[model samples]
Target: MHIAEGYLPPLHAVAWTAASAPFVVHGVRVLTREVREHPESTLLLGASGAFTFVLSALKIPSVTGSCSHPTGTGLGAILFRPPVMAVLGTITLLFQALLLAHGGLTTLGANVFSMAVVGPWVGYGLYRLVRRLGLPLMVAVFAGAFAADLSTYCVTSVQLALAFPDPGSGVPGALAKFGGIFAVTQIPLAVSEGLLTVLVMRLLSQSSAGELIRLGVFARGNARQDGQQGDEQGQDRQRKRVA
Candidate 1:
């Protein structure tokens, strides 16, 4: 499912754990605030972690022997933001490492850094960027989900490449090799993941619209404001040209 037990260099593993520690701290604080202030959010946050665990555990085999799967972190990030996702995703990885024999403790840090940190942040940022650029909600979610899944594999490939570079071609070559192998499995899953997430969100929009609204999931405040400003600038430019 991942780099496997003891596959990564000890120094690299330690470094990644160190790097991810602060984000974990921040995430715990954010999650605690949500639980304390909005008690209902506890269920949602726990659901997010459970969702991540289930999706991530369903690994599809790749040609390179490493498995690929939907991270489900993108949806969580979109719902709760990336910082909160940091906590949920870390817990999910920890459970998988202990129970599933899917990944290993030695590589938990690297796994957390890739799946928990980078994937969610990239997905959340992409969703915000596209929404601000005026893409519709579903479209932005689709982009984010697809990109996040692929990006997780991208990071894992880089980590592996860094640890074991090709003798003749170095890290780049190894990176490409790893990426290509993983991409075959990952690309289709990326698309499927995007579709599934959008479908689920559509259902949630109908059933739990109020909850989502309260959570700011449907609040397009920044995107709407930015979009209006852009439109106004465009209109001004057109008027100036006509004048």
Candidate 2:
């Protein structure tokens, strides 16, 4: 979902940069708190960065003459926290631009704003909301992934509308054209991403990595902690009987 260089006008670029500044600052502050709270978790955050990098690097051709890649921000947000996902996403996009030419340096700020800031926040927010509502883990994962994809496209549409306000036609016409083309590719991609995210979350929930549940990674309720406590109590009872 990289908007090629020159697609956005100078005014739009400046606007996006200005709008994204607060998010960047907030993300940094959040990451700092996380580092202080759980210093060892930094290792996991770095691993998340690598995971995002790999996920974004793999592309699938779409019908819009462009390609789509897994954002992976939902997974990262679920694992480390949304702010950590933002940092990792920025790093991954920078590396992609410099090394693979997947996106342009000039449009890096815009790209970061849309994909990293908008997408991850949307996904993470939805995940948190659903978890609070006691939804199933898989359902939350799907919702998060779907929101992330749709938010990215909405950002893209805004960027396009701002850039080409009047391509001989009105702003509405331009937006329609841009949204139409993007929607064609984004719809199927969103569905695929939703399914994949649900599957991965389910797998993680079942694996030894289920410690993620304790860390508030998945959208599971506090029941996981209660269950762990109950199991510990049962184990203690068994030990007492043996003694």
Q: Give Cα distance to truth, residue 7, candidate 1, Å.
A: 1.4
Question: For residues 1-243, what per-residue lDDT tens digits would candidate 1 score against the true structure?
Answer: 366889889998998789888888888998898799989878887887787778675655544566556688788788878898889888888888788776788898898888888889999899999988988888999999888887888999999999889998999999999998978778877887788788767656545544566668875454333222224465465446445
* Candidate 2 runs further than 4 Å off: 59-67, 208-211, 218-243
Best by TM-score: 1
Checking candidate 2 for backbone clashes, the offending pairs are none
Q: State TM-scores per candidate.
A: 0.82, 0.81
Residue 72 in candidate 1 has what lDDT? 88
RMSD of each: 10.3, 6.6
Candidate 1 Cα misplacement greater than 4 A, ranges: 57-68, 220-243
Worst 10 residues of 1 by lDDT: 222-231
Tens-digit per-residue lDDT, 121-189, candidate 2: 898899879878987767788988888887888788878776777658777877888889878778888
